[model samples]
Target: MMRYSWLLSTVAAALLGSPATADEFGDPEAGAKVYSQCKGCHQVGAGATHRIGPHLNGLFGRPAAGLEDFKYSKSFQRAGASGLEWHAETLDAFLENPRSYASGTRMSYRGLKDETDRKNVIAYLRTFSDDPANIPEADPTATPTDHDIDPVILAIQGDPEYGEYLSSECTTCHQASGGDDGIPSIVYWPEDEFVVAMHAYKNKQRKHPVMQMIAGRLNEEEIAALAAYFKNLDN
Candidate 1:
């Protein structure tokens, strides 16, 4: 009995001192305010419906391109089909550059430059979770793959319905008609070339602070989705 008590006490202590759960990461309050930047297209909170972008409720631990009903870019679908799951690091990287993170994603907001800002945003997202404080720890064994597929090719591989959904954000600034000064008109960019440009922005090899800021947040697949959406634009 004494040995069992000691074992229980040791387990409790270890658990208490153990690192954060997989579901835990960073501050929702700060994330809430920062997320305001995303409100133009995305909707969160209770009973949130899909908007210009799809709903982000319970985004944590969900599939990369998992929103239902709302159309998603082909790139997003491919990523989701590839079995990518949302977590702290994934969200952090994505928040930094949506296009670079996914190759063809159509989200237009530049990523949060500061790491703390990303963490805060994660925190805000956590609030939507049933257990906001404890996020699951990342898989230590996971490593990024070296998929060298062309962005445009991947975009062509994406879904047009999803592309249309993502296009809503782009149309805000990248109108098919003459775009704003400095903002490139995305009416007819080749998918492969667009993917390359977005990657350059992500790596900081490409100039343009705005583009860099936005690109830094994306993944290869997102870049593909955004590229696909623009490639199919009527204008």
Candidate 2:
């Protein structure tokens, strides 16, 4: 089943290009504080024991819906089966909204209305786990510039090749029009709504054992790519 999932995801990826809005992102420090709300259910350290959700050690650059140990919702499993990667822009959108990102998603969180807060939370989160390195090293020869490179665009907008490679894991569930037993069908869902659903999942305000597990796996960029890919699919 996992092998077949890879096959479908490859085909789906061939149809789409890399995302264009990955670079616009914010602070990891703030993301850590925001994560306090999440500690109630998740563990972000490597080699950490699974709590209500699976451990989120290397969340950035991971495949969408790709935790082998966690029992995901039908929808998420389906997404993984289909082939998706959790890029930065995708994460931003998902954090902004979840229910709309993927219909039938079990998460119950509302979302992060403030963009700055969302970016800060994401920034802070990078420091906690292998989510992503939001802070880039300063080049000594160049001007000392702390210009905020939008993480969403940096992660998603550049090259489809990396994104394609990352998405290879989602096909495990999302490729088929009708999902396997536990996974849900996402081919028919609305694109914009899919973005919203991801956000609800990330905010932790949403409540669903499976969704919490899946959302906890993502950062910001991965979420954007996943949302974009699904939005472009034909039902």
Candidate maximizing lDDT: 1
Q: Model 2: per-residue lDDT, tens digit, 1-235?
A: 2223333443454557633233344555666788786676667765666677656666555665677888766666655554444544445555666555545556666777677766666555455444225233210111111222244433443223443454556556656455546555555445345444555566542345566667678766666666566645554
TM-score of each: 0.50, 0.47
Q: Which portions of model 1 miss their true places by more than 4 Å? A: 1-25, 135-235
lDDT for residue 36 in candidate 2, whole number 0-100: 83
Task: Tell me how candidate 1 scores on lDDT.
Answer: 0.63
Cα error of candidate 2 at position 40, Å = 1.5
Total backbone clashes of model 2? Answer: 82
User: Candidate 2: misplaced stretches above 4 Å?
Assistant: 1-25, 128-235
Task: Quantify how close model 2 is to the true structure by its C-alpha RMSD in Å.
Answer: 14.7
